[model samples]
Target: MGYIAFTIGFIVFFFVLAFLSTTFSIPADAMLPIGGLLLLVMIIAIAAYAALS
Candidate 1:
């Protein structure tokens, strides 16, 4: 249940970033780094969960 929630939250975060970037004319480069970092963090969290569980 926690994993599911984390996954959903991670996805929503990126989608919101993308939407905001498009709506606000944010530079692709700036958005890419932020999105990438979020994705990286999510991946690490999931991997840690898998390894420890």
Candidate 2:
């Protein structure tokens, strides 16, 4: 279902971000920009989904 896929994608998104951060030793200062970008992407995704549904 769409709901289940969305939930899984949300979890996977965070997991991949965490893994990449740890693997690359991302700096704290960079996190703000990265988080902002992710937030923007999330908002766009939710809005698009809502419009489609």
Candidate with maximal lDDT = 1
- Candidate 2 at 10: error in angstroms? 4.2
Pairs of residues clashing in candidate 1: none
The regions of model 2 sitting more than 4 angstroms off are 1-10
Tell me the whole-model lDDT of each prediction, alpha carbons only.
Answer: 0.81, 0.76
In each prediction, how many residue pairs overlap at the backbone (N, C-alpha, C within less than 3 A)? 0, 0
Model 2 Cα lDDT, one tens digit per residue, 1-53: 55765787688778877887889999868877886788678767866886788
Query: How do the predictions measure up, each by TM-score?
Result: 0.54, 0.66
